[model samples]
Target: MENAENLLHKGVIEGEEGALNQFYYGYEANDPPEKQLSPPLKSKITGISLKRGQRVRLETPGGGGFGKSSERPLEKLNYDLEQGYVTETKDD
Candidate 1:
């Protein structure tokens, strides 16, 4: 048992919330076996236990952007799209 807090950070700008970390466990049988999933836990998690065949996965969130999206340069944004790091949308 352990106490983990502030698992996620807040975004600097408005409408920009940092991604929440995720924890997954268990197994499911399918064409390709898949791990059973659980919702992101934004707060503290305690008293977790695991069995012999069970597993746990921890997905950490990416860092928050520094400033406004509109302030980003077009060239860099274009490159992100070209390289599949970002996707183009009607809003842009």
Candidate 2:
């Protein structure tokens, strides 16, 4: 048990993605015979959790190596106006 923890700690510290994956397998493989883990947690740990789509708008333009057009929805509208273009703004 301690050996497994040590291995997992090392893997995480070293950013070894594959080794971290193996650690999860090892965890279930070594689960005690009398105890059972719930399915949802296992699924989440394995990255199978339910996902919902989200719309993300960038918030700044031409900063940190971004293009002038790379601005948030509202910010982009402002940019367009500043650039002498017409754009419709969404209301929500």
Q: Total clashes, candidate 1?
A: 0
The alpha-carbon lDDT assigned to residue 69 of candidate 1 equals 62
Say what the RMSD of model 1 is: 6.2
The TM-score of predicted model 2 comes to 0.16
Per-residue lDDT of 74 in model 1: 96
Q: In candidate 2, how many Å is residue 54 off? A: 53
* Model 1 agreement with the true structure over 1-92: per-residue lDDT tens digits: 22233444545764244455667765433323354656446466666666676766676666555577667899988887899755676342
Q: Name the top lDDT candidate.
A: 1
- TM-score per prediction, in order, is 0.43, 0.16
TM-score of 1: 0.43
Q: What is the lDDT of residue 40 in candidate 1?
A: 46
lDDT by residue (1-92, candidate 2, tens digit) is 23221133322322322122111122233456344323322212444332244221211112122223334477766877898553355333
